[model samples]
Target: MDAYYNCLGCMNRQVRVLTMDGQQHEGTIVKVDRNNVYLKKESNGRVQTSAFYPGYGYGNQILTLSLFTLLAIALI
Candidate 1:
């Protein structure tokens, strides 16, 4: 619940998420619910590789990160 409150304090902003696995994700949060945070991953990295399919994963991917897996989150 505290995490949800902390998240609400910074809604609709670009955040850099650091996971427990050491992966870093930068994206604008689209939604945050009870168990997960959904984000639209930035496309800048993929735009340089392929204009037609710039996103690294699939089309317009959204991240559903479990709060338990996150190590840190910062506004970028």
Candidate 2:
């Protein structure tokens, strides 16, 4: 649970998210799991939830951080 407090979404959030395709997005993480992370984004005056997978068998994909803790790290 501690790990969830410092995730990428929590830290450095002032900057928009840069996708692999060079797209920019603004959002905050609402939940995270071993397989994926759930994010909440503001779209057209509405909030939408999005899911992201960090790719399995990649490089150090399994991070030991909870949803909230990971957001904290992102903020730091």
Candidate 3:
């Protein structure tokens, strides 16, 4: 979980997340754990309820990114 901590230090900051699959996501790191990294995207907010909003689209959203798939994370 050392690498997870590395990204853990980035909590609340905008970051670019790269995964092993070549997929990337840019958002603010909200929370992190041993298994996953949670994020609140710039386009999303608390006003938009997660119930109505889809998984990764605009509105209140929390992206649960699996740490196992993470390749690199960079503060933006």
lDDT of 2 by residue, 4-49 (tens): 3334335424323444444445655544555444444666976443
Index of the highest-TM-score prediction: 3
User: How many backbone clashes can be found in candidate 2?
Assistant: 26
Q: Put down candidate 3 lDDT per residue, 16-75, tens digits, no spaces.
A: 989899988888777788988887765553332122324455555677788989999999
RMSD after CA superposition, every candidate: 6.0, 10.8, 5.4
lDDT of 3: 0.76
Model 2 misplaced stretches (Cα beyond 4 Å): 1-15, 49-76
Q: In terms of lDDT, which candidate is strongest?
A: 3
Best first by TM-score, ranked: 3, 1, 2
Error of 1 at 64 (Å): 0.8
lDDT of each: 0.69, 0.41, 0.76
Candidate 2 residue 37 Cα shift, in angstroms, is 2.0
